[model samples]
Target: MAFEVFKKSSAPVSTVPSVTIQKRGLISLNRAAYELIGSPEAVELLWDSDRRVVGLRATDLANPDAYPARPQSAQSNRGPILVAGSLFTRYIGLDTTEAKRWVPQVEDGILTLDLKVEGQPVSSNRRGTGESARETK
Candidate 1:
């Protein structure tokens, strides 16, 4: 008489990792991992395009998973939207006046503030003045 032996597969099963994204463009991270990264203004997300990190975006501080699973971080400064420059317009023959009106636009993870002079849109730079001020952050 001959006996047959049944063998089980030896290869380990692979599973997809879980990822969460918020409407405000913040990638979700576990509490422990967030703390381990020094609580930066933004967390780096890696995309497997070229086998390395390709880009960086600011994390939404209001994401629920950020702290205690809250819906928003209105009371915290974890990822505040920093003003890159002074909200003012320098016009020729006119005193420097603060931008009375401004419009904000966000596209592809970039925030652009379109400042206006007395409700009229104007470029940030002075047209004729040689003054060139570059914003540094």
Candidate 2:
């Protein structure tokens, strides 16, 4: 029997829209999600307590309540859209001790993050080891 080597594909990354709420209250929107929201410079964070869903709506940068959607890095505008959302997270009573990734759905010109949906825990970068940082509880 001949041994075959495993090969990795060089295909482009997924286009499915995804959003992540980091442990430090940073909201990150992948390229697909950013484009789905019209790639605005700012967005308004909305909350529905009854449904426990968070909504994001595009708005002008001048809007006082608007959160600026900045590039993940200064060198790349094509990267994820990052928003400082500490106040918003605290207001919504979300547990920020751990990071979570969720797939968002868009409706009526708004992007929504349903808390009811089970989110995948994002691994922490702080650990030098490559192990997942899942909650002990």
Indicate which candidate wins on lDDT.
2
Candidate 1: regions farther than 4 A off: 1-19, 22-26, 50-71, 76-137
Q: Write the per-residue lDDT of candidate 1 for residues 26-95, one digit (tens) a residue.
A: 3333232233333345433323233222222345556532222232356764422222121111111222
lDDT of each: 0.28, 0.83
RMSD of each: 24.8, 6.0
lDDT of 1 at 57: 34
> Per-residue lDDT tens digits of candidate 2, residues 108-134?
999999999977776544444554334
Clashing pairs in 1: none
- lDDT computed for candidate 1: 0.28
- Pairs in steric clash, model 2: none
- Model 2 global lDDT (CA atoms, 0 to 1): 0.83
